[model samples]
Target: MAGRQRWMTVVCVVGVGMLTTAGCDGTAEPAAAPTSAATRSVTPPVPRDLFSPRPEVVRTPQEACGGTPFRAGAVRAYTPDGPRYDGPGPHPVKLLRMESDLLGMGPELPYQWTGPRPAQLVVCEYEDETFDSRQVGTCEYLGGTVLGATARVQSARFVYRVFEARTGTLVRQFTLRGNTTPEETCPETTYAKTALYDQQVESKDLVAKIRPLVERDR
Candidate 1:
């Protein structure tokens, strides 16, 4: 049996944090007394394995280029760092549409901006693409002196972290891991790239995980 070697490629997209607001009178509120554990409201623990097997990836140029047409008087998505623009584009608008559609909020709930409003905001802490490849065997020439190698993507991992738009508090997070089947091959069809491009699947999984939190906040 031959040994296998593996490597990973990672791309990270990070969101900004929110700023704390001061009181109208510029006076800090006093801390409340601590309550007993039994009386306190306990948040449910996040599952250790929040994984989806078949995640979505970008497939066609149409899907890649699709999103809501730019319209004025729409609410804007505010991150802790600053406002995130979802204007017409290849990737940004597509991402916005995917997220909003999955959440059943149409294409204008979280990213448009009209004027002064409440402090509610949304933040995408990070979106990571982890592509993994491994060596199955070594290739040797007729002389058996020079060697070559072939590698394929065994699986791909995507992690998304979302936070409250105004407060910068993390609302929910999840991971999706898709593995290539035996019939899937490298060079011809890269499984990792396919999975990474399929934005719909990833957006669906993300919305499924965070829908409850979003509703509760609303």
Candidate 2:
């Protein structure tokens, strides 16, 4: 009987130990994993000159004259290296209107100007092309190379003007002209030539001449 009682005590102690271990295990909580730094979102840095008051000029589709007008916006100015930011208002002078009346026969070109209240600049293009051809061979040589073959003459013109928006006083004017004799087989269209003339030549000349006049007015 004592041996059976000791065996029962030993079994009870083992059972209690197992139950205590299970209870402790059930009460314990699991630890959470920490978040990783790599998963966080980050924004890219913007260019400093993006908002530096320099206008953006983009070459647009060609128009009737086969000359594409460069669309200018975002900021305002002539060029990054050519002119300083003229500011956002009451430009040295406002552009009222420009009339090319090209060769004294073409229609007056479109033009405009303004300041903080209204921002406007009109640049127009005029182009004309002529084709001349002649035949100099007999029926035997029909379709053969002609005497004159083909001759094409293309002329492009641009006029820019600025005037005081309020008083209609002319501030500056520029006349730019260029000619191209494309191959005889080439079509009657060119791309972005007018934009180049205005942006590269006319605008540069205008700024150089008018900058001094503008200072005097101030």
Candidate 3:
């Protein structure tokens, strides 16, 4: 598919309220006169989308391997930033599960078991989903009690590319986008716990798609 530009627009609305003081006689005093200043509207620059369009296979494994019944001395996995552990604690459960899922595919794959001697490389680039709360607006109660309203947003993405070890040429590529829904809450509540591995794409599914490229039809 041809690549297209993607953009996300975030609109923030702010509300201002006047403050009143309570008099000793149980009467409310009028708020102080408000100060005004000349204001000019300035356009903020749009941020470029951090995600990219799903990439198509540049070269089939059969083509790169020179024929069908592709065989390799060894196939290895590589990650640019390596495995990431959140904070100082032990590795996250979902992260370990994902790694186990990849390892499970080794038996079915065509390549022999070896890591140092790489005949083909599966490069994995992953972005962990993050959740955060941002104040979107304010809520005022009948008693003039004001509370901040917050929005929680989650986002993540992953990219995998296969390459011929000897030639260092890319053969296949895939991209996985994270599934996220924005949630808003009044009184600025803390963000809810989110699953670390809740992604649209699964390891097995990815292996199924790429298996054909690496294995010859029997």
Candidate 4:
């Protein structure tokens, strides 16, 4: 929303819910301590009530978020207004994400992706409900602290998208901003570089929120 503001953990593109909700997992943590730098982590996103753009909505899928070359239920043409700012018919979806240190606070850990990116736009979908309620925006060394304070800044960007499932179009998009300046450079917080793990988690969580909506509507 606003430009980078101090230290950031996760900033999903959506302003708020449907916009959704969030969490993260415990992996190999680093041995350093966190420096006392003011930082903010973004929250999850989900639609109001439980769903937006009900399932009955229809259209093609976003190629940016879509995994394959040909997205499902999406369209190539824009709206009559001429710009396609709004996503397609709308299957229903909200922005989702988990914040983590990209600086490597511990042993380097890699992540796996269940979906593809740079996708057409409609491909932006998440389905990880098992671990949705976690609030792990930033990763700090298990036992580390910043002493005396220092002048250091290291930031990384996170990428994601919001898709309208019915038409498979991307309604919104987000690129997160974050950084870390451990008092002790040697010991800092690190997060998944690949970030796919977090993405998968986000997708599943969104699905969880949509479940009730899908059922009631069905």
Reference-based lDDT, each prediction: 0.34, 0.32, 0.36, 0.32
TM-score for all predictions?
0.28, 0.24, 0.27, 0.22
Q: For residues 63-150, could you state the per-residue lDDT of candidate 2 as single tens digits?
A: 2112323222211232222323244432333321222221222222213222232322323332312222222211121233542223
Ranked by lDDT, the better of candidates 3 and 4 is 3
Q: Spell out the clash pairs found in candidate 2.
A: 94-163, 95-163
List the candidates ranked by TM-score, beginning with the highest: 1, 3, 2, 4
Candidate 1 lDDT at 148 equals 33
lDDT of 1 by residue, 16-104 (tens): 23223334354644444555888887868755555434442323222222213312232233333333322222111112332323333
Tens-digit lDDT track of model 4 for 1-218: 23757774642322322322232234432333333455544566755657444343222333224433334353332111122323332222322222223332311111121122211223233222332233224323343354232222233344445443333354454443322223333333333221212311233443443333322322
Q: RMSD, each candidate, Å?
A: 26.0, 20.6, 28.2, 31.0
Determine the C-alpha RMSD for candidate 2 after optimal superposition of all C-alphas. 20.6
lDDT of 2: 0.32
The lDDT, on a scale of 0 to 1, for candidate 3 is: 0.36
List candidate 1 segments past 4 Å from native. Answer: 1-154, 178-202
Q: Please list the residue runs of candidate 3 whose C-alpha ends up more than 4 Å from where it truly belongs after superposition.
A: 1-118, 128-155, 178-200
Candidate 1 Cα lDDT to native: 0.34
Best by TM-score: 1
